[model samples]
Target: MLQTDDLTRYCDDHRQEALEELEAWLRIPSISADGAYRADVRRAAEHAAARMLALGMQRADVLESKGHPVIYGEWLGAPGKPTALVYGHYDVQPVDPLDLWASPPFEPQVRDGHLFARGAVDDKGQVVMHWEAFAAHLRTRKSLPLNLKYVIEGEEEIGSPNFDDFVARHRDLLACDVVIISDTPVFSEDVPSLTIAVRGLVNWEVHVDGPMLGDQHSGLFGGAIDNPINALAHIVAKLKDEHGRITVPGFYDDVRELEPAERAEIAALPFDETAEAKRLGVPQLHGERGYTPLERMWWRPTLDCNGIWGGYQGEGSKTIIPA
Candidate 1:
């Protein structure tokens, strides 16, 4: 058996090579949101599976889904060790407004100690880190502390539409003692954190239609009929209160309160309210009046109007009430 020191040294020596491999992976334009890059996304999934197979995953393959594919790999040689399922996503967000990027989105670049690429921090970097860890263990004959199974999906940036179904269908295959994920960032450069919980989300789009007519003269019909735009604005305004608490019916009945110690620990965390406000380019911070910003973000449930539109938004103002 190889010693731990030998494994550590091996990891150190091959750090550059691992990083280069990550750069190559990042160079693939696997934007799942765009239909044009569907092939690129599949290529990325295959590339990831190939890398895992090379790193000693006995069984590694790309599983097809209704959308993009999911790459699965496992090394279960150790009989007594617990199993851990590692989850990550290879798909990336669409690089719209491409001009905003310093370099092309698919061209990896290192600048000022940071890797600049579309999927660098979003997931590819973190997923590659696991591969590096596995390689280090295998090269030095240092058996993994626990058996690991990798599942890399290609539709996370698009809200992981097919993941829940896949998980349900393959529950037996994916059974593990725990799930390991490295997608979230550390609390700070010096503070590493393990997220204990993730907030659930409910997304919706609202559409309001005015009268049957197309565009009516505001002067002639504005006072006689209800304006859909005005109604939508009113509905949005009623969603919150002066205390920043959501006003949705039954929204808070199920909300659990934080323990006193938990609140104290959160308060003690390194934070500057003024700095946070500045970072957000806001004059003041607002959220559930009693909780800190971090608390509101992580623990409290929120209702936000992601987008709203009903009437004309072109150049100058038109004198017509949209219908």
Candidate 2:
């Protein structure tokens, strides 16, 4: 049996080594969204597989896919024990608007004890934690209590475009008693939160067309012709009311209400709206009127416009009605 105390001590003693490993992995800009970073993405996968193999995991390899490859590793020594599939991703979202960053996204930096990198939290860091935990167990106790399998994919940032098919093809290999996903947010820095469920999402690319055949002089056609940008603004503005409820007909008809037990559990969590607002650098918080902040975040549905543009977006504004 693995002694929890010993494992914790081993991890604490080798914290610097763990940080170094994570920093090395973070240096690779494995962005799945852009085709230009394909080689870098593969490099990241190879790096993960190498770590898994070094840590005594069996069959550690970068398995190919139509898109970015998936890294697989397993330690199935404990017979008749529950198999836990540890899922995470090596690929990170594109670092656009790079000018806003204090340091380079790929160059991992430790600032005030916090690691700053592209994949620091939103998954690579968590992936490293799993590997390091396994390392600690193997180094100290020589074996794990239960079977373990790793499925670190490289296309997760791209909405996991290739994950479903990869799983379908390798059903037996990926089978497990329970899957553990570390790619989630904790409630806060001090609180360790386990999120059982997440809200679903739907995306649509809405386009608005103007009456003009092409761009026209806004000064001349401002009042005569309707501007697509103006029309789009109106449409987006009407998506939600002042109370933060969606204006769409029958939008909340299928939404499930929180049970009494669930509400109680949520209420038990420590939260301060004022502190959170201050931490977020906002004067106040806003959400659906009826639900608390936690309830609104965890259960309620929300609609947001991610990107919108219909006019000139350069240094100087072009005085034209976009078509």
Task: Itemize residue pairs with steric clashes in candidate 2.
Answer: none
Return the clash pairs for model 1, or none. none
* Candidate 1 least-lDDT 10 residues: 185-194
Q: Tell me the number of clashing residue pairs for each predicted model.
A: 0, 0
On lDDT, the leading prediction is 2
lDDT of 2 at 53: 91
RMSD of each: 2.5, 1.8
Best by TM-score: 2
Candidate 1 per-residue lDDT, tens place, 164-194, comes to 9888878888999999998886777887678
Which ranges of candidate 2 are over 4 A from the true structure?
none
